[model samples]
Target: MAEEPRDYEALMALYQAEKRRREAAEQNALEEKRGREAAEQKLRPTNLPEFLDACHIHLHASLIVQKNPTMSTQGNPDNAKNKLRPERLERWEDFAKHQMAIWDDIMASDFASKRQFAPLSALEQSGKDLRQQKIGSEIDLHIFQRDTVDKRVSSIIESMYYNKELREKFNLLGTVNFENHANMLSPESQLEEGMEQLTVHQKGKQAKEKQPSGSTDTAGSSHPRADQFCHRTAAFIVEYKAPHKLQLTHINNGLDEIELEDIVQDVVQRKVDDKDDVRRLVAAVITQAFSYMVNLGVEHGCVCTGEAYIFLRVGEDPRTVYYYLSVPEGDVTDTTGWTAGLEGPNRLHLTAVGQMPARPSTPSCGQAEKRHQSSDEESGPDPDTPSRQQSLSQPLSRTQKTTRGSSSGRGHHGERYHQIDRPTFLALMRRQLADDLDTDCDPVGRPGAIGVLFRVRLRSHGYVVAAKGTPAWFIQRLRWEASIYERLRPIQGIYVPVHLGNIDLETRYHYEGICELVHMMFLSFGGNLIGQHLTAENKTLVSEQVKRSADAIHGLRVLHKDLMPRNILWNEETKHVMVIDFERAEVEPISAKRTWKTPTGNSVKQGQTGPSACTKEIRRAMTELNALTIVIRL
Candidate 1:
């Protein structure tokens, strides 16, 4: 053995050969995995929910890595979005983990918000079902539902492998994609010739994979395949509710005109069609995504036109906005940055390089979503169980039994949503106002930041009626109003405006979760008191009302910070006077002294040294102001 030490060269060669053989084995195993995945993909479910559900049961569940807990809403109102530094982004995996955090929040926010609409009875009933042995336990219910969806998914996948099942269940057509199939917003774009032809992989109803070179590049696995590491894009939005990516619904392509910025402008200014809409929109969006997305291969957003959308879900805390054609791509490059030969939307792509698709809304011609008019797509009333809430749906279309590549003859599973009954409520208001406004050019009313007040015929009927929104900035005012009325409610004889019901819109602004835009109707004291001429009798009535109201609010431990001529309503005919608009109302500590700047620009004080420093003196001051306004008007 000692004499054989001279044979080191021969041993080195042998070692090299064994290394090559092991490498070959890894390559073969990788190829086998690719083949098995391809075969499975051919039998994939029709949409994201079904496919992901199946992926779960198949033990190949896609991972959703977590990121920061509270993204958009966290930190200072100052410096909210971390600036886009093409340097900070290191991995598609990190960006994805962050997005999952945000997307999870958005979806959860949506589901939880909507779940508020679900009846307690239904939730109670679900518990009862468990207690009654209808379901073995809470886990059993989950398992049952998962199993139902998984069974369907398994069959859809299996149908592709078994000719008898495939031939019997599906039409000899093509697979579906979510972009078009889940598209509930609008119509389909016209297809060009040769777009319908069957490629080698799509010869059957399922799609083809790994076609080299032309329109698609080594089309790894249509997004969200088992072996596919990156969720790639489309976290199930225009939206995503499921964990799968069967449909391009998971990824919304910025292929059409986007009105998202308009919504942003509206959110910022609280007005529709403002001149500063674009400037404000650009400022907000750029500020939000620039810091983070720049490093992720995005230079800036579509500043010329807002061609962007935010991806949010339940589990994640931060929501991310993606630029057009910018999505994470393959492993051609190392995990440290963008793939080889990858630039950005406009270059500077240091790390997370994304693909900006030069296409329209959908993924494929066969699986593309058919667009329709949102207002017109109505599901006719269901008479058997006509619950007003359940009768409404906006995005979900009526179910049609066509061959949608389901394993059974049934169509894709249709989801129903609740409709905000604005039309019915508005019509009733219009009629109520019509009977009240005498001859004031119908349907037109004076609009304000919080609400639109209509001079209704009801003023002559003794009270004023107004329909208005509690704006985000003015929410504190609304809460104050509610509290004041609730306090004044128990005090006798002061006119507290009678509140009618409010219709809640399911949609929310892009701010914090608490600030919702809701329309409330209140029976006020007078109609447009700002323009009203307070007669002698009206002065007497208003003086008495203000005096009592001021004194009442004090005993209730409150301060009506905003006091003006307009706030004290006057109905000359009925000599009815009432105070309104308690949004700026405050309930201060008994020992604390505070000065408030009222709407009239007067520095009124409870803590300051005014003639009326507290409530009892405040009423006397209101009486004097009422007298002066009445004299000035006359």
Candidate 2:
């Protein structure tokens, strides 16, 4: 019964070939790792900190600020007085402190203090040239109005952007737009009192204008309207006023001398002297900045007079505007460790301005976050009775939906999100997922470190698309989840949400205290929680649907590892159950059946099990689902 010598030699040869193949595979994997690391290194921007420092330095050097000589107020004097007043003015106590903390962190980091890149010398020289051009008497003649101030600031901002290294470092997805084209801020919105006049003028012009012969109404046209509202991706809002109109002295005297509460009342009652007049002027501009901030839903903005920059932030309340004045000429000193010795006015500090642009890159960082709704209240809204607003209000948090406080108890559940049709969603994905989409509302489900689930609407077609994303660190896990969805494509839009393609976001989402996720996976809204519509009448129906969904997944050899009632959704209209959250789910591996020799020298095949592991997991989930149903019924 001994094997032949030639057979043994053949087996040895096969073993050697297998070993060689393993070595080659290992070598290829090593090469791939090296390639990835090299690519990452190349993509990583160099001398960004140096460039930011250079921008601040050059901006201060080339700065030309002239005061307006005219001493007059526009519109009604009463209106001017009213414009300066807020419903309530509360001092943002921690505005400067928090900005300084970020600055300190930047300074303490290794990259901030590193040696300058080679191109930075050329960049600084260009800045010096700009400073030289502004040295003449022509600078004296130039009135530092909104346009002038914008040009001066934009010179530096543009310079920072043009540099390939700095753009990469900041991850500059959105532009620093001087022009405010937001539909909410448009004249028709009437965000400001005087805007009604502008709206009337526009309407009158529209009436006078004739349409082309045989042309239908733009709104009624089958084609997309040319005048459709387009959201300009603004990194942050910058409100500029002439330096002479709103001076550094005005801000210092108005804000420092008077309490915010008193300032509001003083402006309203038309109380007091020259100093109060200056305060009223400062307040008017601050009020303007607040309006723009609320309309845009951006938490941070700056009111930049040619001379000084008033870094502003809004907290949980839309009306409450926080201000921190930064005077580049005085506050920033050209010393070896000036940042270390700075007392206040951290806004224009090199580190602070440097860090500011990166805020939009990480949209959630350093902003207040709304509380996640508990599982009991995660059912969302009933489709039959959709009590929702026509337009979105500015949320307190960067990514949270608006909350209305009413005794009707609807405020506690948060705003209901509008849904997009499947055809529109597919068209958007086909075009470009990242470029076409913009964050519409707050996050949908509970956000974990691995990923954050939120709703993003299409830019041209305004309809919400559910996006699941994670930071680069957790991208693999997100990819894994996406792969699982791909495997379950057969049941998509039936027992699960439709799987839209995945994409890398054009811009990075920076959530303060949370991950800055760049990778996004798009999916259809998977309906609401199972318990939301689970009742005595539909309990059997719900249970059958849930069981059917579980079976469908199991049939695909996919095990729903973390299957629970929270992960299951029941669509009331469709009366179908959809399962979600497959982060921990696994596709069962396929293997050949094993044959073993018995002690009696008889060949026998391995016995089959009562049920497969995938089936077992489904059964276990069903048991938990049944228990949850019982609890809900009670």
Candidate No. with top TM-score: 2
* Clashing residue pairs, backbone N/CA/C < 3 A, model 2: 67-244, 68-244, 362-510, 363-510, 364-510, 364-511, 364-512, 365-511, 365-512
lDDT of each prediction vs. the true structure?
0.32, 0.49
Question: Any runs in candidate 2 off by more than 4 Å, and if so which?
Answer: 1-49, 67-85, 107-110, 113-118, 132-235, 257-270, 336-352, 355-634
Per-residue lDDT of model 1, residues 1-634, tens digit only: 8657758868888889999999999999999999887666444422322222222222111122122333111212112233322111111224344434432332233221221111223323333443332222212222332232223322332333233333333321333222111100001101111232222112111111112123211112111111100011211222111112111232232122234445455667777543343334333433333332222222222211111123211112123333332222221122332222344322112112111111112121122122211111011111111111121212111111111111122323334411123343335545544343234311121122243333232222222233344434444444445556555655412333433334332332211111233334433222224224445555555566566656666666666654544355443433444456665565544454656544223445555533244543455446545545544554
Residue lDDT tens for model 2, 73-179: 12211122212234555565666566556556445555454443324445455556555433211112132221223333333344444555554554434334233
* TM-score for each candidate, following the candidate numbering: 0.26, 0.36
